[model samples]
Target: MKVSSCLFNSLLLSAGVGLLAPLAQAGEASEEVKPAPLELDTAFVTATGGATDLKDAPASVSVITREEIERQPVYDLNTLLRRVPGVTGGFGPVGEQSKIKLRGLDDKYTLILVDGKRVGSSADLSYRRDLARQDLNWISPNMIERIEIVRGPMSSLYGSDAMGGVINIITRKVSRTWTGSASTHITVPKDSDRGQTTQYSANASGPLTESLGLRLGANVTRRAADEVEARRDAQGDFMYDDGAGGSKNQSVNALLDWQINEEQSLSFEAVHGVERSWASKKTFGDWGDTIGVSFGPSRLTRDSYILSHTGDWSFGTTKLDAYLNKYRNDLDMGKANSEEKIVEGSLNLPFELLVDQRLTLGGQWKREELTNTNTLGTVPVDYQGTPVSGSTLKGDYSAAFIEDELFLLDNLSLTLGNRFDHSDKYGNHNSPRAYVVYHPHPDWTVRGGVSKGFRAPSLKEGSAGAATESGGRGCGSLRPLGYLTGSCWMAGNPNLMPETSTNKEIGLSFDHDGWEAGLTYFHTDFTDKIEYGPLGQYQGRWWTMLENVDKARTRGWEGTARVPLGDSVTWRTNATYMLESRNLSTGEDLISSPKLSAFSALDWQINDRLSTELSAQHVGKQRGLGNDFVQSYTTYDLTANLALTKWLTLNGGVQNLMDKDLRDGSTNFYVPGRAFFAGATTYF
Candidate 1:
C-alpha cells in the first residue's frame, strides 16, 4: 500500500481500537478508585539506582510529574530538561544532537537510564559526543509517566557517567485494570522560514489476569520541508543559515509484567524505531547538503532486554532484601555500531539498633562487556569499490559498593556511602559520599552534602582510527584546518585519563499551606577534563584531536516556588543561575553553558472540565570555546486543555509565542521559531 494511505489507515485503526476497548470493559463492575494522598515529597531512583523516597534519600533530587510535562507544552526532551535547575542544553546544531549538562558538566559526566538500565553509547567527544540518553524525538509525550532527576555524584550506586547526576525516564506502565487512549497533534509554523509537524500516538495497557499485565504504545511523526534564510556578512558571504530540511519518524514499544510468586516478579519490554531526514547549510550564493558535509544520512536502531528478581526474608530483628538484574543492548549507527551486555546484583539490609535510630547497609556488583565497529569515512568503499579499513573494539568493567543511613535524632539524619571500581582501561579507583539532613520544624528541611565521582574512557576514546596518508587511499590531501581548509577531521587518543570530580552542596526546602519553595547552592571541581580541540592548521589542513585538559570549576544556585492562588489556580516558577570558568592554561568561560536560565508557569483550572497555562523560559548569553559571545534569548508558551466529556479531551498550545530569533554561539545555528499545535485525546 502507498505510504500515505497506510498512515491514514493506521490512524483510523488506532483511534477506533483505543476508544472501543475501554468502552467494552466499562460494562463490567467498576473497581474501587483510591485517590493517592497528596504529598510534598519528591520521587526518585538514581540516588540508589532503586526507588527511594526523595525526602529520605541522601542526595538532592527533583521530580517532574506528568502534569508538569503537559503544563509547559514541551514536546522534546531538551524542552523538559531546560526546567531542571543546574542542567543546560548542549552545543549541537540540530535538535537530535543536543546534549545535556549537569552542575556545569557535559553529557559524559551525567548518566541517563531507562527503566534503570543503560542502553546507548556515551562517548564524550569535542565535536559531537555520543550519549546513551534516548532521543526524545522518538518518544511521544503521552508515553512518559514521570521523570526522576538526582543531582550530584551517584557513581557509588549507578557506576560511571553518574559523576554529576542522573536522569531516569520512566515510561507509562499499566496502572489500571484496562485503559487506552489516542491523540493527534499538528504544529503550524508562524512564518515561511519555519516548517510544520504532525504527529499521532496510541497507547493501551491492561491486566491479562490478576497476576499479569501488559502495555503497548506506538507513534508516527512527520515534518514538512522548510528553509531558513541566510545571515550574511560584510563581504556578502553567508555567515550562517540552515537550508530546507524535513524528517519522518516511527516507533513502537511493548511491555509485560508477571508475578511468578509471592516473593518474585518478572518484567520484559522492547522498543523499535526508525528516522530519516535531510539537512543542509546555506550561504549567500552557496548551498550544500549537510549530509556528508556536516554529517551524512544517518540511521540508528536499538534493542534491549532486562530481567530482575527481588526477595525479602527476616532474620530475627534484621530484615534482608536482594535483587538481581541482567541487561543487553544492541545499537546500529549505519557505518558504526556497538553491542553490550551487563549483569548486576545488589543486597540491602535495614535494621533498628535503638528505639529512635536505624542503620542501613547495601552492596552492589556489575559486570559489562562491549564490542564496537567503525568505518573510516562516509563511504567505506576501497580502491576496488569495496569497503575497507574498519576496526573492532572491545572492553570490560566491574564495580562494587556499600552505603549506610543513620537517624541520629527525630529531626536529623546522616548518610555515608563508598564504591570501588576496577576497569581494564583505567585500572582501579574509589569514590565516597556523605550527607546530613536537619529538620528543625515540620515545615522546613535543610541538607548539606559532599561527594567524589569519576568517568572512565569510552571505546571511541582509545580505539578510534585516523585517516593517515600511509594507511588509506585518497587521504593524503585531506586537510581540515584554517579558513581554506579541506573540511572536517577527527582523530582519537589512547593515553587519555579518566575524568574525576568533587562536589559540595547545601540546600533548604520548605512547604506550608498551599505554598512550597526550595533553594540550593552547589560547587564542583573537575580534573583531567576531556577536551576536543578545534580544527587547526596541521600539515596545512585543519585537524581535530581529543585530549585531556587541566582543572575546571562551576558554581551555581537554583530556586523554585509554587503557590496556589486559589482552589482552581496556581503559580510555579523556577530559576537556575551558574558561574562556569575553565582555566586550561587559557582562562575562559566554559563553552555551551548559559550563565543564567529560568522557567516559570502559571496554571488555572477553570472548573474540572477546562484548564489553561502560560509559561516562559529564559537562557542567558554564553561564550564559545573560541571566546565568541552569543546573544541571550527568551520564549513564551501557552496551553489549554478541555475535558469535553468523560472520555474525550482536547489540548492546544503555542510555543515561542514571541517568534524569537535565537542562535547558539557554540554550534552557530538558529533554533526553531514560533509554532502552534493542537491535539485531541479520546478514552473509552
Candidate 2:
C-alpha cells in the first residue's frame, strides 16, 4: 500500500508538470506569465489589523478557503476545524455544546474571533461544562470567505483567552456585483434504528453603492434520533442501556458595511439562533419513564449582535489605525440561562524606519460579563435522607494589552508583546511574549517564538454549589463509595489563581516549483493548572480548582503537498503527528491526550463536469483517568461533485464509509458511523 501511494503521488506530480509545461512555455513566448497576483498569495484583513503574505507572517498560520470548505463537504465549523493540524474537537451529549482544543490545550485557552471581534459567552459561570462558549453550529460556513488560524498566544493583540492561539473567522463581504446561492443536504445514518439529518442554507450579498454593501444569510438543520451505546464500567463491561436522542437548530445573520471614504469604515452585524433536543436520560436525578428512566427535552435559544467602526490615517510616513467593537449575547436554556456583553477597542501604528526595516505598536482593552442560574430539579432522597437544590451566579472581567514588532532586515523580524488583565474573581496577571523569523533563501523560511500566556479563574471556580451523597444507602447511586460513606463536597474557592503557561515554538516553510509544505514544533510549560479535584477536607464531591503542576508539553508536526495531476486534476495530501505528555514531579504520563493521529485525502477531477474525493482519518488509543481506556480506530469518506449546468451543481458524500464505530477521548461520546449526504446548490 505504501508503494502504491508513492507511485500515485509521483504520477500526479509528473502529470502536473507536463500540463503546466505548455502554459509556462506559451507565457514565456508572449510575456503573459507575470508574478502571481498579490491578493492570491497574501491574506487581507481590516485596516486596524496587520496584513501580510501567509508565508511572511512570523507565526504558524493556516488559511482555509471557501473552495476547500466545499470540497471537504463540511457541514459546520467543527468538522472543518478537524483538518487543521494540532487541533481537536470534543464530543458532548448535546451537539450544540461541543468545544475545540488546540495544541493539547483546553478550550478555555483558545480565543475564537469573528470578523476580528470577540463574540461569545463569558467565562463567568458556575457550571464549567456550560461555559463552552459560542456554538459554531450556529455560524453558517457558507458565509465564510476564509479562515485564518494563528497557532500561539495572541493576547497582546486580541486580549484574554488567547493563551493557546486565535482563530479569525472572516465572513464574505459584498464586492462589485450582486450574487446569491442556496444549497440543501440530506444525511442518513449507518444504523437503521437512527434517523437521518436534513440541512438547508441560503445567502446573498451585494453593494448598494460603490461605498456601501450588505449581506444576509440563514441556515437550518435537523438531526434524527440516534442512540448512544451503553457506557463501560471500571472493568470495561457495558452498563445500563443509554437510549437515543435528536436535535433541531436554526440561525440567521445580517451584515452591513459602509466604506466612509477610503480611510474610515463602519460595519454592523446581528445573528439569532435556536436549538432544541430530546433525550431519554435525566440531567441530575435518577427516574424512570420506559425502563424507569425519565425522558426530558432540552431547548436553547441565543441572540447576538455586533457593531464595529474603524479608522485609518497617514501621519508622515507612519500608518495609524483605530477601531472599536460592541458585542452582546443572550442565551435561554429550558431551566436556566445567561446574558453576556462585551466592549473592546484597539489602536495600531506601523511605520518603516529604513529600506527593509519596519516597526509596529498596538494596544487593546476589553470588558466582559456573565450571569447564570441552575434549574436542575431537587435531588432524590436516599435511606439517609439528604436534600439538594439549584442556585445562581454572576461574574465580570476586564483586560488590556500592548505589543510591538521590529524588522531588523529583509529576512529577519522580531516581535515583543505584553498583556495585563484584572478580574474581579482572579485578581491581576501579566504576560509577555517574544518572536523571531529568519529567511535564508527564497525557498526556505524559519520561525521561532516564546510567550507567557494565562487564563483567569472562571466564575465556576469561585461560587458553584456542591451535591450531597446518600451514605451509600441507594443501590442506584452514581456517587463513589467514599462520597456515600459520609463525605460531601462544598463550594468553590474565592481566591483561586489564574492558569499560566510558557509557550515555545519553532517552524519552517518551503515552497518551490510546484511543491509547498510546512512543519512546526511547540512546547508549553504550565503553572497553576486548573482541574476538578477535592478541596481540602471536602473529600467526595469535585470542585473546580487550581494546582501548580510540573511541565506539560505538546509537540507536533504537519506537512502538506499539492501536485496538479494534468490540467484538470490535483492531488493534495497532508499528515499530522503529535506527542503530548506531562512531566509531573512524580514523572507520570498525562492521561486523555491522543498520542498519535493522522488524516489524508486525494482529489480527482474526472472532468470539468465531475470530481471525486477520497479521504481517511485515524485516531490512536488513549488512557483515561483510571484503568479505563479508549481504543484506536480508522474511518474513510468519499465524495463527488457534478456540475449539472453553469447555474446548477450537485454534491454528495458518505462519511465513515467503512462503517467504523468510534468514540472521542475527551468527552467520551460515540460518533455516528457511515453517514451519507446529498445536496444541490444553485448559483445566480
Candidate 3:
C-alpha cells in the first residue's frame, strides 16, 4: 500500500496548528522574561534498555503514571490499555478469553514484561492457543510505579516475541521510610444478576536494615458472571450461549533490594498469582444447531522467582538477571503446564573514538518446557516417534545483540543495532534497526526509524503431536472445498517458518510549558505469516495443519494532545486512524481491529480536597469473519476523588455512563452496561 497525498496533507495541517497554537499563547504571556528550556520526562527505560528521555527515545513510547492509575479504578490491564493509541483487544467474550493486540497484529506477536523480566503467557501451553488472555494482571495496580508502551517492532534488542511491540510494567521500589496502604472497592451493575465486582488490596515498602530494603503487595478480586438468556434446544433442553465470564484473582509479590555498596546493588523478587474463571457456553452440531451446554470453572496459576545484580563501575555499567517462571491450568479434561528458565546480562560503555558514542552489548539464554494433556494425550505416540508416557515438549534458544548511539551533531543523534538469535527448532535469524532523532528547535523534535523483526513458531504450533478437533464449520482449506459432514482434525506442523516483518515509523512533536502534541505514521510489511489450514486429506479423515502461507500489510496514523484548560483543569486525548490492514492473498480486513479509535479525558481539581475526571472512548467499525463488519460505538465514564484527611482517601465512579449496549446479535464481543463503584484507601 502507498501513502496518499490527501492524508499526508491533513497530517501536515494538523501538526502545524498544534505546533503554532502553543507558541502563540506563549508569545502573548511575556516579552521581558523568557520561558525555561523545555525539559521532558527521562525515567522511561523500556525503549532504550536504560533510563532515557521520552523525547530522545528512538521508538514511539508512552507512559502511564501512578497518578493516572489512582485517579480511576482499574482491575485489569486491558481496561487501562484502552486509553493508549495503536492498541486493541481480541474478539471474544470478555474476561480470560480476550487477548491484547498491537499494530493490527495478533496477541502472540506482542511481548509482556515485568521490571524488564518476561511474563510467559498461558495460551502458549493450552490447546486453545491464542484464545486465552495474557497473564498481565499478576501484579496489583497499587504496586505499579509506571507502565511503558513501545509500539512497532523491537526485535533488534529484545529478540523474539517483540515483532509487534512491547509493554513493560515497572513496579514500585523500596522506600527509606516504612509506609503502607489498604483499600477496598465494590462495583454493582444496574442489572442485579451479573457484573458485580469486589476487590481488596494492600501494599507496604520500607527499609529493613542499613543497606537493605523490602517491598510487599497483595490483592484479591472477584467478579460475578453476566447472565445470558437461555434458549431451548431441539431436545427441549436449556442451552446458554457465550456471555461475559466471571473471574476470581489473587496475587502476592515481594522484593528485597540490597545495597551491596554505593556502586553496586542486588535484588531478589518473588511473585505468585491464581485465577479461577467460569462461563456458560453452548456446544453446536455440524449444522450449527445447539447440542449441549457446558458450565464450569477453570483454574490457572503462575509463580516467578527472579535474582538480579547491577554494578556501576568507573568505565561503564553492567547488569545480570536470572528468572524462573511456571504456569499451570487445570480444567475438567486435565491439567496443562509450562515452565521457563532464562539468564540474561548486559554491559554499557561510553567512549569516544571518532565521535562521541554509547555502546551496549547483551546476550540471553532461554529454555522452555510444556506438557499439555489435552493436546498430547489424544494419541498414544509422541513427536519423536516414541511411546507416550509422561512425555514433555521442550525447546531452547540463545541470542546476542549490540547497539550504539552516536551524537553526530549538537542537535542530531543516530542509533544502530542488530540482534542474532539461534533457535533449536528454527535455526538462526538476524534483526537489524536504524533510527535518527533531530531537534531543529529546543521545543520541536523529529524522529524516525526502520527495523526488521521476526516471531518464531510457538512450541504448540511446531509439535506434530498436538491436534484439535471441531465440527465441519471449523474446517479450513486453501480453496473452495465443500464442507465435511463430520468432524475434522487440525494438527500442528513441525516444519513451519517464522513470521517476519519490516516496520517503519516517523513522528514529529512540540512541547512548551506542559502543552504537548505529537503525530506519528507507521507501516509494516509482514510475510511468512503462520496460519492453520487444510494440508490435503490424511487417512480419509481430512486434516488441517499450521503453515506459513500468508502475507499482510498494516499502516496507520496516531495523534496525541495535552492541554491545560486553566489553573485547575486539563484535557488529554489520543487517536488512531487506520490506512490499510489487509491479508493480501484474500483481500480481507484483519479481524477484531478497529479502523479508527480514540480516547479523551478531562480532569478538574475543584479544590484542595476534591478532584473529578470525565472520560470517553470511541471505537470505529471493525471487520469480522468473511464479509461481516462490526458497527462503531462510544462509551463514557465519570469518576471523582475526595481526600477526607491526611491519612484517608475516598473514590467512586460511574462506568459506561451513557449505558451503551455493545451487543450486536453475535456472541463475538461483549461489554457490561452502566455500573457504580466506590472505594476507600487508608494510609499509615
lDDT of each: 0.62, 0.59, 0.78
Off by over 4 Å in 1: 1-43, 72-74, 90-97, 122-138, 240-244, 280-297, 315-334, 354-390, 464-484, 487-489, 533-544, 663-667
TM-score of each: 0.82, 0.80, 0.88
**Could you tell me the lDDT of residue 278 within candidate 2?**
56
lDDT of 2 by residue, 1-684 (tens): 012444434433432332333333433323222211112323644211367666667667778787667654455576667667776554322322145667767667788777776656433322234323344566676778788887767665655677788887887766457877888776666555455677888988888988988989998987655443345545654443333466677889888888887788787777887766655331212333332121112456667777777677774122222222222223243234555566656566666666333334444444433334432222232112344344445566666666556778878877776777776666777777788878899888898888877776654455433232222222122243233344333334445577777778888878877667777778777777655443433232422223343456666676666677677666666565665555454354555455665667777765555567888766566554344456767778887766556676667767788887544323343456676666667776
Candidate 1 C-alpha lDDT tens digits along 345-419: 665566677633333344344443333333333224322233335554556777777766677888887877888
Poorest lDDT segment (10 consecutive residues) of candidate 2: 32-41
Q: Comparing candidate 1 with candidate 3, which one achieves the higher lDDT?
A: 3
Task: Select the stronger candidate by TM-score from 1 and 2.
Answer: 1
lDDT tens digits, residue span 160-271, model 3: 9999899999887787788878888776675443457788999988888999999999999887666555434345544344355677889999999999999999999999
Model 1, residue pairs in steric clash: 292-295, 382-386, 480-542, 481-541, 481-542
Off by over 4 Å in 3: 1-42, 90-97, 230-242, 281-297, 380-391, 471-473, 476-479, 625-627, 664-668
Local lDDT at 561 for model 2: 66
